[model samples]
Each structure stands twice: as C-alpha cells, then as structure tokens.
Target: MSDLRDPAPYDALLLLSFGGPEGPDDVVPFLENVTRGRGIPKERLKEVGQHYFLFGGVSPINDQNRALLEVLRKDFAEHGLDLPVHWGNRNWAPYLTDTLREMTDAGHRRIAVLATSAYASYSGCRQYRENLADALATLEAEGRRLPRVDKLRHYFNHPGFVRPMIDGVLASLADLPEDVRAGAHLAFTTHSIPTSAADASGPAAEHGDGGAYVRQHLDVARTVAEAVAHETGVEHPWELVYQSRSGAPHIPWLEPDICDHLESLHAAGAPAAVMVPIGFVSDHMEVLYDLDTEATAKAAELGLPVRRSATVGADPRFAAAVRDLLLERAASERGIPAERCALGALGPSHDLCPVGCCPARAARPAAAGADSPYA
Candidate 1:
C-alpha cells in the first residue's frame, strides 16, 4: 500500500474509550474500576449498578467499541493506511495500561490516540489524558518503553461528525407526525458534569469560564439545527440541553435536563421533539438509558411524540474524518502543510494540549499535554 504519499509517522492507532461491563457478574467490578479512589459505599455502588441491572447487567459500550474498532480497521485497510488499530478502555478489560504494554512489546514506538470523546472537558479530555498518564506510569514502573502518544484534536465541530448528526436530526424530524413536524423542538443532548468541572473545562482563561465545552456544543447545535431546518423545511426550534447527570443534588451541573426540556416543550404546546446526542460519539449506555429509556418514558407519559437521532457511530464520514485527521497529524510531524477541517465557531483544537488545561480537582500527570513527560 506504500506510495508516493509519505507513510504515517505513528506505528499504531489506539481507540481510547470508556469501558463497560460485559455481563451480570462484571457489573460491580467494572463500576468499582470506574469509581476507584472515590469512597462510595457498597450500597451506593449497588444503586448505580441498578442502571446496568435493568439492562441485564451488561453495558453496551464494549460491544459498541468492538463495532467501532472493526470499522476503524476496515477504514484503515480501505484507505491504505497500514498502521495497526487497537482498542482499549479506561475502566474495563483490554484496559489502557494492558493495551500499551502489548503495543510496545509488539514493537510500536509511537502511537496516536483517538478518544471517543469529541469535546473539551476534564472527563472528555483531561481525564482521558490522566488515564493515559496512569497507564504510562504503571508501565514505567515495570520498565517498559513508553511510547510518544498524541491525541487527535477534538471533533465537536468536525464536518464528518457534525454532518452525520445533522442527517440524524433531519431523519428524526421527518419521523415525527407530519402535522407536528414544523413545531417540533430539537433538544441537543450531552452528558452533564458538575458545574465546577464545567467552569474549569478547556484551558483556564483569565475570564474564568468554561466556554469551550458549552460553546462548542452550542455552535455545533446551531450549525446542525440550521442545516436540518434548511434541508427538511421544519424550522425546528432548538436548544443545547444536558442529560446523564450523576452528581449529588446540591452539586449543580448543566441545566435543563433532557426530560425537563421535553416537559417544557410539551407545556409550550410543541407537538413533537427530536433528541440529537451531540455530546456522544456513539449510542452507548448513556444514550440508551438516558434518551432511549428514561427520556422516552417521560415523553410517553406527556403524550408528546419524540424521536432520538443516532450518534456518529462508525459512520463512514466519521471514519473518513479519522483518516483525514491521522494523515494531517502525520504530515504536521513531518513539517508538511495539511488542511485542518472544522465547521463551526471554534476551529480545530490544538493537537498538543497546553499545561493548565482542564485541571482535575487535584494534581496528576496527564496525557497529550505540554507537560506530558512521555515524550
């Protein structure tokens, strides 16, 4: 597959995602891995486990990651990008540390990480970096060769990611009752983190705000909603709302939850609604439980029609976008000019995160940052 085009600089591509339990027996342990160091009691763990219990104790994320991994492999093959593709999770089997050990043993020196998250936030960006840091630290303790890993830029406004969401929302609008389509409300949904986390997301600006997370979502929401209106002629009213809030009640998070947003639409005489999971890369447990089950149940009780649009799960365009980003990063490493593609207010985020970006509640080494000692 080699040609005049320069070969990819990285030896491997790692698909980093949040992991989930595979079966009934795996639930508690998986959650323990997720909430490690946070001193939640067994009862609280069981309470949260109920969400998985309702789903037969299986989280769909691993299977979804498998599907995405295959799609990425296929995309790499078709595009003649010969780099090996590997998948690992932060909190389950095929864990990031294990994956890193195997990758280095297989003789891969440099790796490119493509996190499932497409936005900027601690969990979305820094937390993943911290995971990488943890994994790398463990590997170093065992005296393994630490590879240079560069996370790809955020894709919140990437044409490929946003385009599929636009298509999904348009299809959802069309699914509504024809008479109510024009009056339908588009509720763009994403996970809600604590208000403190929200305020500290992205780089800590002197202005003291978390603009990137909210701003990027809103920009993408506007772009998609306007396109959906233009293409479907629905003129749907839309707002960026949040879902999957897990924090304590007193701790504030992004406001106007999806269910609440649905109720507001119903009370305002809106006849139907569409949920665009703009915050997620795929329809994982959050999208399934929150939007499919919980929010749908709420809409049913209100007698309001609702349709949930698909996330950009292994969509060909998104896969292509990954290829484009990889090639661009490879070119940049070689000092070659490569185009950076994005569609909304914020342009492409920096390939290398600067220090002081997305500070955790406390200090820890993070991945893909200026202070990433990995290099």
Candidate 2:
C-alpha cells in the first residue's frame, strides 16, 4: 500500500508570491522593483503608487501571505506531512534569489513551488518560472549547488479553491434584500491582461482567442455559479468580467471592467449583484482597492446594490488543497498512481508545463518546465 502522505524527493515547498509594499516608505521602491525594466519615469511610478498610498502605502498581500504561511505550516503539521514550507517574493524583500540561497544553504535539494497566482498566463505562470530561473542562475554563479525545482499545476478549479467562492456568493446573496435577492446577478472578476498576452496563455498550440487564461477562469466561474444555483435553488445570471488592468491604453485588454459591468447591470434593471473575485488567491490590493473601494463606489453611484464576496485568504481548505497537490505530485514523481483533483470541464492542469507554455513577448529561460535551463 502506498502512503499518499509521503512527500519524498521533495525536501521543501516554496510559497512563491508577488510581493507588495509593507509601508509608506517601501511603496516607491517596491513599485520600482516591479517596473524595473519598463523604463517608466519615476514621477509616473509615483502616480501609480498613489493607490498604495491611499491605504497608508501598505499592501494587504504580504500580511495575507504571512497568514497563509502559518496556515500551511499548521495544516502540514496537523496532517503529519513533514515537508517544510518557505516563502519568497518577486518584487519585495525576502526576494526570490535570497530565499533560494537560504534554501540551498539549509540543504533542501528538491523544492516544489506553489505560486500565489492560480491560472495560466505569462505574468501569472511563466514569469514566476522566469524568476526561479533567475534565482537559480545567481546561485549557480555563486558556485552553490542548485536544487531541482518544480511548480505545481494551476489550482484555479480545485474544489478547495472554488468551493469557498461558491459559499461566498451564497452568503452575499442571502445578505441582499428579499426583493432583490432572486434578481441578483453574478460578476466573476479577475485581473485583466492584454489581449495579446491572453491569446498567448497556456501551451503553444493552445494559444489563440483567449487561450487557457480566459478559458480556465470561465470554467471556474461556471462551476461556482452552478454550485450556488444548486445550493440556493435560484439560477443567477453570471458574466466573467475583468479588472485591475495596467499598461498602455492603446493596447487592447480584456473588457467589461467590474465598474462598467455594474453600470450595465444597473441600466438593465438588475436588482443586485455579487462581485466574486475568482482570479485572486487572496484579498490583496487588487481586490481591496479595485473592487471594494472603486467598484463599490461605482455601484453606489449607480444605485446598484452590490456585495464583494470573500477570497480564499488563510482558509484551511486551501491549505489542505495545497497538501493534497504536493502529495499527488510527489506520488507521480515516485511512479505511483495518484488521483488528481479538480473541478469544471478543464480537468486537472498538466503537472509539468510544456515548452512554450505562456510564452513571453521576449523569450527567456524559465525554470520548472520543459524548456527550463536548470532542468
């Protein structure tokens, strides 16, 4: 009998995340780190930093990641999974390179990375891989033995990820007035990338017409809506919407922003609506500022009753799902059969990202994939 809990051949798990500013003084530097190569002017970046400044220049992401780390450690310990988990960020302190060096010094040879982003896109998926590759390169230059790193598949459709949103939608609907409850529409929201990037998401062959990014999001939205319908006995009309778009306005990006969608719903005489942030893993800046502050204000102006649903922040179910994912991948690595879990029509994502998966505008080495130089 195979013990599924054995996380062998994987000495450590890394909680890879897109880090944010911790304080007012850290905001500009953090933004500088994010926009390093973009050649954007410093004043322009300061303009962008205003969003962070509004909340005293603090981003909720780092704190949420901290909470998640605690939850994952607790979950692993309680479930008898001995794998040690470490965290690293892309655009802030405790940077990926420094964390990798620490992990190597600590003698963790085989590492499995769980990125905070849960879908397939260059920024969401491949860029994280690129960061890992960059970190490994630094270690290699320093004459340190680089550990083998592998990223777990996207968990957007995992029951542990989706079930919470479904419950959130239900809770939001129940909170609405009785007259508007049945007429409430569902707005499934995610970060909006450029259309070109969206088209290039996922494997090379799958690129085109929204590709895996939009498709995966639609799948999760459908599953959540169906589950909500089943639980409430009311079929709510839902539409997948986009939010938190950055970059040049001349370039095309995903459309029907949450605020716009709310306006349209109001014009259409929809009684109420629920903003389900299916794209985010936690209630980070995007969710906090974009949805809660901006969109909520828009809904109020339009006299549209709106409720922003909860994210899977520090949820124990998500922690258990991470454990399940690690064990399943470990089992597969050991040439053992394991049941991969997911929801919706997309099924489980591939364990290893294939060549050209979520290709970047400029080609670069990405770790933990078919084309990884480290591999």
Candidate 3:
C-alpha cells in the first residue's frame, strides 16, 4: 500500500554518486578508492591526481551533489512529496554504507536510490547495485534490519534530463560567432568505458554490438540534434564521441577521444563545434578536466572554436523530473497504472534491472535488481 503524497513503500530517496577528493590531502586516497582493485601504483595515481590539484584539489562533484540535494528537497516540498532525500557517495565521506546505516537507524525500511549516472554501463548501473549490496551486507553483519532498495530507471532520455541539455546546446551555439553558428558541428560526448564492457551493457538481449551504453548515448545525441535542427532550421552535423578514457593503454575503450575528435574537426575545416556531454549528469571532474581543460586546450591549439555545453546540475526541471520519477515508480510499485514519461527513441528503462544486466568482470552481489542478493 502507498500514500500518494508520501510515496509509501519508499520512505527515503538516496542520491548516490561517485565521490571525489575535497582537498589536496584527499586526492590520492580518493583515487585509491576509485581504483582499489586495480593494481595501479601510488605514483601513477598521484600523477593522475594532478587533475584535482589543478582545480585546487577539489572535485566539483561533492558540491554539485550538495546543490542537487538542496534542489531535490526543495522540489519535494513544493510538490507535496514527503520523501526525505539523503546524499551518499560510493568512494568518499558520507559514504554509501554510512548513509544507508543512518537511514536504517531512522527506521526507513524501504528506500529508493537515484544514481547520478544517467546511462547504463557496468560502472554506471551494476557497480552501484553491488555497492548497495555491500552496504546491506555490512548492516546485516551488525544485526540491523536491512532495507529493501530500488533504483530508479535510467533517466538519460527523460524529458526533464534531455531538455536542459538541449537548452545548453542552444546556448552554446548562440555563444558561437554568427558566421559559424549555422555551420557548427555538434559533438555529443560521454565517458569511455572499456569496449568489452560497452559491448555487454544493458539487458543481455536488447544491447547489440555496441551495447546499451553506446546505443543510449547515440539516441540522446540524435534526439538533441534533431531538436536543435527543428528549432534552428539548420541540420547540424553531429557524431557521438567519447571522453575521459582511463585504464591500461593496451585495453581498448571507446574511441575518437574528444581531443582527437577536435583535431579531426579542425583538420576537416569545421568552422566551430559545441561539446554536449550527454553522458554525465553534472559537470564533474571528467567534464571539467577532460573536456573543459584538456580538450579545450587541444581545440585552442588547433585554432578551432569550441564551447562545452552545461550538464543538468541542480536544474529545477531535473529536480521536478526526480519527483516525477519517484512518484511514477511509487505508483507502479503499488500496482497502479502510472504515466511513464520519456523522450527520444528509447522509452523508459526497466524499473528493476534484469539478471545478467550489465555484468561485472567478476560476479558480485548487487541490490535493486532481479539478481540482487538482498532480495
């Protein structure tokens, strides 16, 4: 049973995200957490930590999550939704386990999680589920009654999520010189996962060669591009690109890195370009360093005009979308027919991830899915 205003069956909403370093001292440790199982050396991690140091050793993700929490709370209040929103990160302070323990201590038995990642991939979806399982296991070890957790469907194509990106692209295009505005090419970018992982993303059947990761990004890019053309009356040439690639150089990941893509565009004599980060929910380290600092520098060197569009960070519309998602899922859980809103080719993603969805390299327990052990 559920209360319409309270979203019963779900007493709390957890905002889960990939945490980042808050200061110079936290950088190496944060990186260690991110690459725990990987046997990368500490020196290499410190070298990688230069990106954080460049930005005063602070990752914008934590603050962005804080702002998002504030907006989600405000939006919930305004809309009469009574669910309390809590923030947690997989790798940093206010960690997922601690937050879940806090929720349990407060007597929340049913919880809904909204990961900051918008698309489906091993890291994006299943890893978070695994973390949830880990947290629940820890609670069980401590003799706490673990809560049942459900993850919200992927919102990459949700109108609330897509619309802000569209507006951002429009704004970036407007910022370009009038001469190049009509001819500017749109580069839709996302984080580059290993090719094998991308091949295995989403449900086992639905995702084909490139898997759901690539397919989802392409869908968002096409939808946004088509909308931009419809509004501006110029069909700007666009292609899905990848950024923020990490891991062994020998291992293949998504290709045409944004910097390399920029070089290509410059060589091809494109007047200008706009980078649309459809992959990230907010302007985190990847968006800031990979695109803004690194790729922007590359574009500058190539004498190419480029503007990085904004991510949907704490946008009121996104907050409203979150509210809509919580309500929609709540109704569905109660076996009531609820309007599932989505834009673009892909309809709403599955409410619960199927077994074998986004399989990890080594199988681990995951919560909030059909394969979740907690259930």
Off-target runs (Cα >4 Å) in candidate 3 are: 1-6
For residues 1-375, write the lDDT of model 2, one tens digit per residue: 246779988999999999999899998899999988889888998999999999999999999999999999999999888889999999997899999999999999999999999999999999999999999999999999999999999999988998888888988998988999999999999999999999999998889999999999999999999999898899999999999999889999999888899999999999999999999999999899999999999999999999999999889999999999999999999998999999999899999999989997798899999999987
- Residue 304 of model 3 has an lDDT of 94
lDDT score for residue 241 of model 1: 94
Across residues 273-369, which tens digit of lDDT does each residue of candidate 3 receive? Answer: 9999999999999999999999999999999999999999999999999988998898889888888899988898999999889998897899999
Between candidates 1 and 3, name the one with more favorable lDDT. Answer: 3
Sorted by lDDT (best first), the order is: 2, 3, 1
lDDT (CA) per prediction: 0.87, 0.94, 0.93
Cα error of candidate 2 at position 268, Å: 0.5
Candidate closest to the true structure, highest TM-score? 2
Instruction: Point out the higher-scoring one by TM-score: 1 or 2.
Output: 2
In model 1, which residue pairs have backbone atoms overlapping below 3 Å?
A: none
Q: Assess the local accuracy of residue 76 in candidate 3 as a C-alpha lDDT between 0 and 100.
A: 89
Candidate 3 global CA lDDT score: 0.93
Candidate 3's TM-score: 0.98
Residues 96-118 of candidate 1: C-alpha lDDT, one tens digit per residue: 99999999889998898999999
Q: What is the lDDT of residue 88 in candidate 2?
A: 98
Worst 10 residues of 1 by lDDT: 1-10
